[model samples]
Target chain A: MPGNRWALRYCGNMLSLTIKEVSLALREGKISPLELCRKCLKRIKKTQHLNAYITVTEELALKQAEEAESRLLQGVYQGILDGIPFAVKDNFCTENIRTTCASRMLKDFLPPYNATVVQKLLDQGAVLVGKTNMDEFAMGSGSTDGVFGPVRNPWSYAAPYREQSGGAEDDSEWVITGGSSGGSGAAVTSLTSFLALGSDTGGSTRNPGALCGAVALKPTYGLLSRHGLIPLVNSMDVPGIVTRSTSDAAIVLEVLQGRDLKDSTTVQSPTSHAGFSEDFDVRNLCVGIPKEYHAPGLSQETLAQWSRLADLLEGAGARVREVSLPHTQHSIVCYHVLCCAEVASNMARFDGLEYGHRSTEDSSTDAMYAASRHEGFNAVVRGRILSGNFFLLQQNYERYFLKAQQVRRLIAEDFEHAFSAGVDVLLTPTTLSDAASYSHFIQADNRTRSTQEDVFTQPANLAGLPAVSVPTALSSRGLPIGLQLIGPAFQDGMLLSVAHWIEQRVGFPSISNYEVPNK
Target chain B: MLGIHQIYGRRRVQLNIILPLLCRYYYASRTDNMLSTNVKTLRKTRNTPSRPVTVARLYSSNKHNSKVPKVPTWEPLGEDRIPSLPQVSSDLVDKLERLALVDFRTKEGLVCLERAIRFADHLNMVDTTGVEPMDSVLEHGQLFLRGDTVTEGDCAEKLLPLSNTTVEEYFVAPPGNIPLPRREERASMLKHSEF
Candidate 1:
């Protein structure tokens, strides 16, 4: 069986090329975008059991690819990303395509327009491969909470992509793809998409990417326009990039980050692009090791990888020192309060009226609203709304919501202090441990599991700092471990350069380069 | 929500039901209003039991919108310092249903609210003395506002189709309380007499 698994790895290399490799091939006229799009579509169909995608835009993808192919052949390409096949997390609205947010509420929701990011990619001639699956309303730590079923990690031990033994039940005892951006993470790592857009409200993108062995990036807040990316936590939400390598992530981020009139929260002034030159150096870097990130429940394997990277950085002529962010202990709790409050506020918009699930069997307007929400949303999403509403309550507003905001200020200030004190970037573990199995992941409640899993990632979202999860190495269990590098606000380029340096030194294994059997 | 029926006992539930009907009857007879009369008449002559009727909920939207929860007294743990749990109640659950519009009186919803409050109680341990609340991380830079000039308009034809229920020119919705119908009932009624 192991031999067969290895033999199957040789079935294709066309699906496994990175965005940079794919771009070179396209430019050299060795591979047409249409051919690549067809292969991507075929790969998606082959991996349908993984449940990584909610809607595969085969027809539209082919149409876009053909147009790109024509432009490429005619030597009138729009840009470097012209004809690159990429996927968008289902949360981003795609004009005339279903954007479910992986919730039953939007099971049939087709948006009237595309998200700003989606439109930008399309305008640049990037082919829209499909919309990836995610937690319902991007709310869970494990993608299992998504209505479409869990996005199984390609590297999970329950082999051949964690096919359920029960067949019908999605609750198989397999390793989880950390979420709420689990599907986007799965898509990139599994070679289903070259690049995928994942929204990082908390640790949604990094959590999943770390578990799935993909580089996940959350740019500084407002670096990317949030226009059509459905709001999870309006302020914390940023469109994250998922790719096999740091450079691929940097290339994608360069295209996606910009201001627009559609998203008011976009950074008003033009910010620096996250592109680093080929001669990037680590000598000038001052890396901070946040002592607060040695959080409880952090696995020894994860700590060893983090420390190993710190040693490597120090040995490579970069200064590494311990920095303390005292408010870190209180961040997870602060995140829950602020995140839930925003969730309740954003969810109030979905009442079975404006472009979502509508329950026709109900009589009263209130009944319809209640029935639609109850049926459309999963327990995780509904629970957040209820609790969020509790915080936003007139009486509790002062204690929960207001206090949370004040703590949020302190949290952001901690990052400000660390960055101002001459820390070019902070190094930490992306997740507490390697991916946990579905059986163990579900042992705790969604709220507790999310809190524990998202502890490291959430603080970055709260501080509105740019952070990236670079896949460091394989754990003893053969699952991937990722290390996070968080930079000061708008210093995304410097952060990527450091990440690229680490990525080169670590040389984490991507599926594309995995050794096949009988070579 | 079952309205007063959920809160009141069986004996009091009957009186609670009659009181709303009486108020509707009073509003129905007021000659200045006709559309309100139709809604009242629909409830008045219906043969079915008023089990699913929500006459009281129209005003319930604002009933407890301003009610605040009493903050629990915080106590330090034995050296480890785990924040003590916040006290959760059925009244809080009731308000959640009213405000969020989800049925939180269920076992799952109820458990979630209680657990979330317990998690949120962690904030009480921190000394957030003189910190001003940061509403948005974008507070350092102002939001880039566009001119007030019309950027998008005249797309009612495109917008109305997104909803499942739409009239000739507009989306069909229960405007505030009474669900507005397709075409003005009186205008159509005056145009053609029903059998």
Candidate 2:
């Protein structure tokens, strides 16, 4: 077993250890952060085919790990994240490292400033191993649209080489790693990093979490600052955390959550008021399963897992009941319109003039503008920007943009009503099904397919609710099926507590079946 | 080439059924040419009162006007001419060209635009009267304004090198033909010029 294999490599079974356990071990002088860094780096190098990282900051990570090791020796730990190897999505602006967002447009673009979360993690002595790959400009739900190519799911079997075929048999057929945060999820799942940061617009984080079998959190909007997050849809976007366990997500959340002067949209008060505890009692909590979420096209396995989770919750003393969110039917539509409108506005900044890729097709400024945009953005991003601009047109505004915004309010009201009526959290499927094989996924047009995939995840974003996707069971394909727990705004802690409890009950398997010995 | 003709053919059929005016417009403008030439031919074909708006008339126009045509004024097509084709000519492409200053149009651009409209039509079916449009999710919180105090003062020296086209103290950019600096050029210059 991998656990036994890990025991032979380190003092104990390091592969199965959570972030909190690692922290405890570090504090007790059982292991050094340098050793941890070395192990993580070795794993990252070994799994290079996963394409999980856009940029690996080996020098920076080792330097930070060395500092962390000395601090541990001096008995001056910088709290939980100190020396913990982690990664950030490429969209987050790292000070010196290239933050490409997996787009050719900003392939060489380095930020002059760090994102608020990046600075926060650095302050806590977190060792940043790399910047992970993402959908170009966070515009896609499938990871294949990334500039560096698709990140393969770590759980996907890599068939042995076949001499008859003169190639590895079926190795070229990759399983989908769900997008936007696909690389982060893969990194965390494969134990390349203990914690990784992702961003959730609709289902960017949770989609990958379900596919990669990682715990992913999209906290309440504005709780975390967006000062340095490359905006997709600013109102719905939040910095998501991906980790092996819910507690690791919580630990990272606590370290990153705070009021930031840089991001005015951040809540005025600090997140300290909403305290998180993994040990909260689930006895008296009420879990609501929205009826509208049980729509057609949901896989049999996912539905079964959903039912099993509700049964597990009810068996553990939480009241489970069917709740009606009538507006859920209209969520995907509203999400699309609003997302396009905002994306059109936000992307206006990317004209061939400044920091990103400038088209060399020079004739006139106007021609250059068109050429740059056409060349800079992928087909998917260009499609959104064009559609968004169309929706915001004077004649179409009332019919599309304004109407979508009104429906958005209805969506939010549905959540407020459910929460006000005593439901502490909503239980739903994280994705329509398990990870789609690459060949199966590329059949339909990307925009249509992506919209359908966001059906379960978009409503929470439209309503500005905090949601966590926790893996509950493995599909018949040995891929994971995640169940999402969504809570009202500012109740992120309570939402995570329920997720943690479910995680404990399920005992979901990890994909880290390999371990490197500490040097 | 690359199956775009098939997409256009499919779009033309759908446009004919749903929006006859747009179908005539699309037919009158069908060409394996740039957006400018198509727009020019569309303006000429639309202005002619002799031609009956039909699929046959569209094909005939394409056959007869296969030769290079005279350059026409790039007048933005009015809403009436491209009626109800929210995916193709909902003033978004025009605005992107004129206001947003982007001009690139690909063969499948209209197809992608149509997909978004189809998605919006899904939302348009829902009734949402009396519900106030929400800009953000926060209900009770007021805009938290920061004090007008200097935080980290100018760091242009650190920021300018991020862009390769920087001049002595500023980033170099394309010149505006107009007296006022073009919004496009200025933004391109200032994004990396932190000071």
Candidate 3:
């Protein structure tokens, strides 16, 4: 009601509004939360061909929107996000809502309790739009491995080609929405939802956000609570935020960050809120460019854009220097060892005899367990489990698992030393290249491809550092290419502030031209 | 003479029951052709009305009415698509299955196992020594264990409905061949074994 006296002026439709704009509209009585929900639902229905959502919580969304409208009318609105509609990746449990982590094992598993983050958002009057799809068990770099089917990148949908010769080929390839949080990225990119939550473990959130042209933040480990967030790699897992801009990501991060009794990994005291102003001074900021990150697989377009961004920052009085993170070369291998080892331990609980899908085999308990898991999990998940079990074995434990852990510490220390030496933030490419075609992506093995995809992103997770993917340029094929900015642990505010400055200067083009009706 | 006749009749009936069971047990353990034939013969004679025993199935399937989805087909990739690595032997796969409680015997499972081994080969290239392994991401915090208290009180009644095999107040599992000692069986065998 504070902004209600302002003149209510909105564009033709609500789909173009950001979360901040939507909240302002709600407060100014330009549109009711119910109206906003209905518009979003319509957009979602229109974009069904994208396959971004596994379950659309239509009824629940309408109910919450009604509550928000009533609160607004009573002059007791919650905050800026009071009536915002958003989606979360299906991995997070919602009370009585089906949370299938894109695997058949949890296809029908309904959690009896809500994840702490979901409860926090709902308490702030954020309307739950639906649950988006992802890579099964968050194990792959592409979202094609989901049981519900793959999510197509909204930016990569090319129109049917007309042939001069008489024979026509159908769209031979569909562009992949990078995973395992691809659906959430696609949802926000296509303007089907105002915002969405993606869980980042080794770039699950940033990869998709980069490909889909959205802002994704993987906050520093322990800065945000991880309770009830179905773990992929518990030590590196953090709930990430996906939005159209850096400010929205920061706002949502504020709403979600806290110290929780249920999660022991959180900071002892609540960190300060992520507040940033347009006038936040970024002059003379020291930006590090890790020389090792300029690897062999990086594309020419991405490299050019990365260089251009550095020049822009330098022109704005920031010192862009090539800083050496010596351990960067081994981070990916170290990440794989730790990720698999942790996955082996975390996935043991889904033996099908407990909360997930059970096998029909009654032969023996052991046989039943094997059969259930074999039938429930996909190839990607099964591969990780096998590799994890091997690394954690007593015979190989010292050689593989223990050594990887030591290397992991070195990687974290590298970031610590770099930050301690007055490097304000480290700038790198979010991914090796732009989004690949489904045909090209599946050509390689899932593990190999995933490792390649996470090369630039996983180090942030391994070091327990905060990182964000900001879309900076377009590739020749017209796909979005994102650059990453990572800061020291618990320095998320400074990291995001510099990212915000870059975002305003770049003013990158979004994916609006590809919203064609499904043929 | 009359008592002997009655005893012989009882012995004949007992033999009829024990003979089929013995054949089944032998058939299960042995790969001999003659033993398998004997099992078949016993099974054929099992339907005779003289020894009436009914085996009822609590679960039945309506397979005819249910429609099973077809498996998706995809174009196969050439050998070059898959990077060659140290091949995991079948024995190693079996060990992995035992450790993971997941099968890798099927086609898809085998493919997954091969891919995993290939990924492991990549991790093997790194050299690490004297570095402490970080089991957790916590920099300076120690594990905080909660006080021993009843956080989750009795929720058996709420949880019973979650499974399909709930009977009365207990969740039931399919009875298997493994002979687990039950509470009633323990009470009955108290005299034979030390408590």
Cα lDDT, all candidates:
0.76, 0.74, 0.74
C-alpha lDDT of residue A408 in model 3: 88
For model 1 the local lDDT of residue A441 reads: 85
Give the winner by DockQ: 1 or 3. Answer: 1
lDDT of 3 at A205: 95
Q: Going through the candidates in order, what fraction of the true interface contacts does each contain?
A: 0.41, 0.33, 0.29
lDDT of 3: 0.74
Model 3, span A433-516: residue lDDT tens: 988988999898777788789989999999888999998755545567899999877777777788888787665655553234
| DockQ comparisons of all candidates to the true complex | 0.15, 0.13, 0.10
Computed on C-alpha atoms, the DockQ of candidate 1 is 0.15
Q: In model 3, where do residues sit more than 4 Å from their true spots?
A: A1-9, A158-170, A268-275, A513-519, B1-87, B107-115, B121-125, B142-152, B175-195
Residue-level lDDT tens digits of model 1 in B1-195 = 112233212221342365433222111222331112111211322344444433322222222211111111122223235456566675665556767766653576677777788778778888988889998888867778889898888877767777888778865665357432222332232123211
Candidate 2 lDDT score relative to the true structure: 0.74
Give me the runs in candidate 2 sitting further than 4 Å from their true place. A1-9, A13-15, A158-168, A268-274, A513-519, B1-95, B99-104, B178-195
TM-scores for every candidate against the unseen true structure: 0.82, 0.81, 0.81
- As a whole number from 0 to 100, the lDDT of residue A424 in candidate 1 is 87
Error of 2 at B15 (Å): 53
